[model samples]
Target chain A: MIETEHLQKKYGDLVAVKDLSFKVESGQIWGLLGPNAAGKTTTMRILTGFLPATSGKAAVAGYDVFEQAEEVKKEIGYLPETVPLYPEMTVEAYLSFVAEIKQVPKTRKKAAIDRAIEISGLAAVRKRLIKNISRGYRQRLGLAQALIHNPKVIILDEPTIGLDPAQIVEIRQLIKSLRGEHTVLLSTHILAEVTQVCDGVVIINEGQLMSAGRLDELTSAYREKDGVYLRLKKIDNEILNLFRQLPGIDGAAQEGEEIRLEWDRNTDRREEVIKFCLDKQLGLLEMRSLALTIEELYLRIVSGGVEQ
Target chain B: MKAIRSIIKKEVLSYFSSPIAYIVIFTFLLLSGFFFYSLVSWFNSVSVQLAQNPYYYQQININQMVFSPFFNNLSIVLLLMLPLLSMRLFSEEKKMGTEELLFTSPLSVTQIITGKYLACLLILLIMLVLSAIPAALTFIYGNPELVPFLLGYLGLFLLGAAFLGIGIFWSSITENQIVSAVLTFGTLLLFWVLSWVGYSAHGLWQSVLNYLSFFEHFDSLTKGIFDTTDLVYYLSFAFFGLFLTHSVIQSRRWR
Candidate 1:
């Protein structure tokens, strides 16, 4: 479990994170969605006890990050954006060192290291120097080090930044598997990753908390204007005008072969329009539902001046 | 204590895992060994021929050949080698982004600093121990005073520790290791020259300024005097540097 109350981090005249209050419950993947320079890393650093908040408080596993940072650290593992690693160290050596520093029990350190390596899919590169491995493997090594301690919470900042698509999927799946074992706070600018992996999404922008809710809630909330596309074989201009003049029809736009109709927010006029077309002896081919994506909602929240 | 030991062990292992420790120790032995043998041989030839002139030109032997030459050369060796050893103490972590990893771990700032300091001291100890071979060889041919040698080494180790602390603090303030090394070398050069500059001052002011010099106390150590004041002075210097390092790291968290 992790929580922040009005968390603020300011460096002189610049504010990096402001009033970011959120709680992450156990066995849930909480996605922190924000563009670059949106204070995601700053928030993660504060919660991980690497940086101090300018005001307010951060807590991890019931321990205050400021007052009891050591205890907080004991309960959490953090993978910074760059995935800090020693290039000269072998994967096993690096993980073992992380275990030692994380205070993993001596008797269980080996098992912990092996389990992390397996989870990160780094067993093949366990004996190689980190510098010799590819970037994807290095990222996995970073994840392995963080997970070696089996902390109650794991905070990953941009876990998949430079990897190719396949590696990204593998890492995403690895992170997905951690859902039930640890409370995960994953931050990224990638919208689709949140939809695929995270249970809840916390959208932030320009160092401000924008919105926080379930993934479906964000998508459904953004599904405000349900427009239907209709492709007809033949229709007279008078018939088109009459259909457009329907009381429920908010607006209409026509392409060469297809016509798109817009209704008042969430209003469905598809059935009426279809019946009208049938009554007028106009042929109909296709109809479908269009949903707004998380990206559109993110842009709306940031640009529409909706302050959270 | 466990955290401190873990950090210390990791730091030491990091040194051996690379070639840094070997390079530093090798260069230390090469430079100090060459200077030691060359000076002892030159002094041996002069002392043998000019037995009566030994006490006649007492200033020349003690100031040039015996004390000043060796201590000055040893200080230069330390000046060159310490930055190489200490420049990576915190700067590399800052550059690699591992400082976040270390700071966010369940270790106190004191534990981290002390571990790093102990690792640096261990490296200094290794260099000092190896340099002892040439110091012992000096006695094989000449009647060099063992006490002065011991005191000089103690002073050098303490001075190196203090320099390391300063270098580590400098490393913590920035992510540039080259800049850290240059700044450390520049500051140490200033400290090295301050004692000679103190020699030019007049009256009570000269004596007071001399007391402030790094080598003023160090010179007494190389003359076979184990002054407690010199020990306290070096200890304070090292402690102050370490304290400043701790403060810099803690302040960085807020910034």
Candidate 2:
């Protein structure tokens, strides 16, 4: 539903977004993962037709963003980083205004507002002025405004930046519920958010694309070797040295009573280690493979371990 | 058209929902009323003095002595007050980060500008209509020429429109309301004083300065003379201001 090719945006001498390219399929939740100043917001603004790319192309819902901005705008809902709102307006009135500006059909405007209010859990504060609402409520109101139009694509910039733990969980659940219905492209620096809510991720750093793929595919593709974590009842330096001296075992480190063993990919040294432990009467309590979490993968990619 | 209407409705609602609309209207009415009262009293005293001499009485006319200066005083009040009406038109949106919402919407820059311009015009219309209450009192007591009185109001509305145009343009260029208001007032004050400087200069400089001065065109309209030149001047001045605002906002997207 959204695509960009060689999309570059430069503010005078500074390039905010370099030759970046990514695609999001229909009804798929894709997270644009990057640290701050990684061109995430700039990319969203260009895709939403809010800013013109200095060079390259972007399209949303099969319409060229620059050539058919009005059509693209009508087909997408955008929530900026700051959640632009009028403090004087009531929540319902604000939503109604958004619906009108989004060009919702007059006959269905009320229904649309009600649905948004219901979805964002804003019914209780519907009549309250925006300035009087709490921060979490204001955040929900921002999401409600973006969803009020029921557009094909929803682009959110830092949707959960300043929320409490409970509010963050509620927002994450709300976004997860949007799966299979709306094509969501939300940007965030939080790695866990992507693992929890997104089907795929496009990670960028310093205004360049570092990696992009499904979560499982990215984890496996970036996994370089196999690691087995072994917890033994009686682990000592002699046992760790013997394990290190074993063939096919690349490295071994003893952690208190546990031994973490590393080997070449596609090798199983657990049998050899077990035999050696049995010969020495070392008690083997537990053994498990160490899988790389998204947090580690994100840190690796963002810290320049992998660049694309 | 619907987009423009939505913007206008929202802006008008915003104006009324806050204390801005009430304060501006009340202050405008009070100041205009004060000017009218003092101008009328001064006119009444002078007329009473001239009543004893038939020659002086023949030269005295209510429209000439009262409503013309009344419109001029109203223009000064508008010059001061219209900036307050327009300072927040685009500045508040920028300051509050709502410009992103507006720019990302399907509405064009022209539509947004026109809607806001028309909304401010509506408020100006209301202010003028209410100020007319004091002017209408003149009809009850004396026989004033109605055409000149109405023309004076036309001049004030045109002047206010021109001022709002400048104010909106300045608002678009800055995110600070105070800065916008000051820039608008400073620009309007320069235009206001241009006529005074024109009276002292000679030849080409004088005519050029006089022609460029908004006060000169507005002064002609206040005298009940509806020249197309003056009409075109006010309209074009307003159009030029809006055009500048459009260019500034459009260029911002590129930056």
Candidate 3:
């Protein structure tokens, strides 16, 4: 439901978002992954019509963000990084005000507010002033304001920034429950969140698009690093050379009695390695598949250059 | 229209939710009431003494004895009070970071500004309405002239609205409510003094500065004179301030 082409934003001599382009499909949970100062917020702001792009074009829900901003604003719910709350207002009052401003029909305003409060898990604190609530509840209240009108797309920026672990899990579960019902475009510095909750991932660094695709497709490209680790009772150059010559092995690294073999995800070098060990009479102590995590892929793409 | 109404409703709710509204209204009423009564009693003593004397033959009415000078003092009260009413219009939003909510909402810059402008105007209207309590009490002593009394209040309302417009613009330019309040008072004081400064100049320059003074138009209107030029000046002053507010808000969205 979101697309951009050469979307660039600059503040005088500083380029905040540069040559960024990505697309998010409807009803999909897409995670925008980047480090601090990586232009994720700028891109999201442009898509939400809060900030105009310095150049290029962006559209949300099929409307040009700059030209048809009001319509785009109507179709998306945005939870900014800071939560942007009126601390003096009660939770219910804030949600209802959001409902009114979002133009929810008068007949459905109460129901809409109720639905958002229920979804954000803010029923108990509905009567409490926003400033009196805990940080976790405040974050949820921010979510409630965004969801009050039930916009087609939900955009959240670092939704779990300051929350404790349990609160983070609760909020993550809440986000996960939105899958396939509403299109979600969320940005976070949490990499494991991308793997656990996102249907697709878009990795960006330094205001540039680094890598983006389905989660499995993204990790599949790094299977060469997915290998088997082994520790043997004995070590020799001849045995190391023999193991490196195995048919399924892509490469081998030996440090004293320990050996690690690298291969693609589809390769099964375990059986071959065991047979060779038996044949050579070398005692094998440990062997297991070392899976490559999205974090590693992220690090590789960020520090190892964008070629991957 | 719905957006504007929602904005005004939220602003009004917010205004009353804080002690600032009560304090502003209370100060305005107390100050105006004090001045209104003292001026009325002073006028009463003067008119009484004049009636007893044979040397004074100039005609004295309630409009001349009470409304004219009381309204001028009312303008001074407004100068002290209207800034407090409008100081938080945009500055608090900016300081609290709630402008993100306002700027990103479906409402346009014009809608947001118009809504806020009307909310501040409503506060001034409340103060004006409450000031009428003192005005109505004047009926206990003498018959107040209808046209001049009405026109004087009209002048105060217009002048207060213009000052509120300027206050909102100043609030938009900075995130400090104190700065906004002080800057508004400073600017209004500058306008107040411009007419005094016109005394030293000669010919067209002096006349032009006097015409440009905010109180000059207000003074003319309080005199029961119906001049479209005064209306034009007040309306344009308010419109220009609001237009600048809109520009400040719009420019904020870019960087």
Most accurate candidate by DockQ:
2
- Which rank order by lDDT, best down to worst? 2, 3, 1
**Residue pairs with clashing backbones, model 3:** none
Better of 2 and 3 by DockQ: 2
The CAPRI class of candidate 2 is high
Q: What is the TM-score of chain A alone in each candidate?
A: 0.89, 0.92, 0.89
Q: Report the lDDT tens digits of candidate 3 across residue range B1-255.
A: 888888888888888989988888898888888878888788779888898766673577778767888788889888888888788989998888677777777878898889988987888889898988878877786677778888888899999988998898899999999999999999889988888988888899999888878898888777888699888888888999999998888887887
Candidate 1 residue lDDT tens string, A1-308: 88889998998989999899988888899999888999999899989998889998888889999998889999998999988898878888888888988999899999999899888999899999888999999998888888889988999999999999999999999999999889999999888898889999888887888888887877777666777777888645765687679888877777667777778765777789889878877788776555667777788876764443
What's the distance in Å from true for residue B242, model 2? Answer: 0.5
TM-score of every model versus the real structure: 0.89, 0.95, 0.93
Q: Order of all candidates by TM-score, from best down to worst?
A: 2, 3, 1
lDDT per residue for candidate 2 within A170-249, as digits (tens), equals: 99999998888899999998889999999999998888999988888888777777788898887778888888898999
Task: After superposing candidate 1 on the true structure, give the runs of residues whose Cα lies further than 4 Å from its correct spot.
Answer: A226-287, A305-308, B50-72, B138-146, B202-204
Ranking by DockQ: 2, 3, 1
Off by over 4 Å in 2: A237-249, A266-287
iRMS of candidate 1, Å: 1.1
Per-residue CA lDDT of model 2 for B1-255, tens digit only, reads 998999899999999999999999999999999989999999999999999999999999988888889899999999999999999999999999898898888888999999999999999999999999988989999999888888889999999999999999999999999999999999999998998999999999999999989889988788888888988888899999999999999999888
